[model samples]
Target: MSYEECVIVDIDGTLAEFDAEAVRQWVLGEEKQWLPFFEHMAQALPGVAVARLVGILSAQQQKIVICSGRPASYQHYTQTWLEQHSIPFDALYLRPDDEDHLADEVVKKRLLQRIREDGYQPWLVIDDRQAVVDFWRAEGLTCLQCAPGDF
Candidate 1:
């Protein structure tokens, strides 16, 4: 589909439930466990309202492009979660494993360029993070904030 037909969607805190305090502690802790964190996130329940919105958008034939800050190394888990939830997506973009240290906004900006290069002309974005919402707006796309994502 053309760029105008594409709609960008975020995973954590948007399509999926996210625990900010748990994540904050994980990030601030000394060990910084990734596997356990990913495992926990993989099992997170889908956001009912947002998932319903996505389903409606899918039914309307809008291309749902899932762009997430989650590491690509755990793509299988993410794919499994989406499938289990029956969430339809035209494409899935995840942050590179090596780029895990970077900020979510930075990682997503690069991914957005790749999405454009791949022929999706994204007209709208659905995200949770305030920073990411601001970034998408800066990039000239209308962003719908699904949750309060100050963290």
Candidate 2:
């Protein structure tokens, strides 16, 4: 017999779009222009749609972990965003204890190592990053790409 595994989600695209206004506020000196571009990268899940998706995933009782390239603080933003949108997920995986840890390739490798060692083997992983799918698959994890409009 086999046990049901968890589901890992990506913040941008897979569920919600990056908050440009939020990111814009952080772009202080040289990064102002890039702020608006964040909007192009993701689509906000419709409020009702997100709630329904959460319902579907919750009914299955699968552990939903959010993995993002953004740092830990972003996780707070994500949580707040969830409340704003009514989306649901269980845990969050991120960088440098909270701020984008995987920016460096070596760090990413180590972070992934930690995730595997932690025993949170996901039944399904959803990500907007194709490279992540490829990498996780190589590590023997099931992954799904968040293609255009993919729920």
Candidate 3:
């Protein structure tokens, strides 16, 4: 299928819900402490909106892509997390382990561009940050902002 028909989703504040403490630890780069919390997040259920979206997209045969700022080192846990939530995905592109210095928006823009170049037309992007979704929208990508309470 063409890239334009693809739906890209973010994790963290978008699909998976994380407690404040867990988020704080992750943002603080406390990997040792955050790893366990992240594992728990894997088993944590996603919000209804995300679950419904995943189901509808999967049924339509649309490509469901995960484009998160998460480092690639967490790939295994992230995948397991998605599976545990029964989220369907066609592709997942995470940040390289060394790009911790880059902002999420920068990483997202770059990756989204790459996805387009790779021949997947992104039809929609679901993200939690208003700014991120605004940026995507400004770039002519349709984006949905996930409500904060849903995170």
TM-score of every model versus the real structure = 0.92, 0.64, 0.85
> Highest TM-score: which candidate?
1
> Considering only N, C-alpha and C atoms within 3 Å, which residue pairs clash in candidate 2?
71-98, 71-99, 71-100, 72-98, 72-99, 95-101
lDDT of 3 by residue, 58-105 (tens): 889998989987788989888988887789998899987777777678
Clashes of 3: 3
lDDT of 1: 0.89
Candidate 2: which stretches are off by over 4 Å?
A: 1-4, 18-54, 97-109, 148-151
TM-score pick, better of 1 and 3: 1
lDDT of 1 at 53: 91
Q: Model 2 residue 100 lDDT?
A: 33
lDDT of candidates 1 onward, in order? 0.89, 0.56, 0.78
Candidate 2 structure quality by residue, lDDT tens digits, 95-151:
565333233233345666656566766766665545566676776777666554211
| Rank ordering of all candidates by TM-score, starting from the highest | 1, 3, 2
Best by lDDT: 1
In model 2, the Cα lDDT at residue 3 comes to: 36
Candidate 3 runs further than 4 Å off: 1-4, 20-22, 28-37, 149-151
Better of 1 and 3 by lDDT: 1
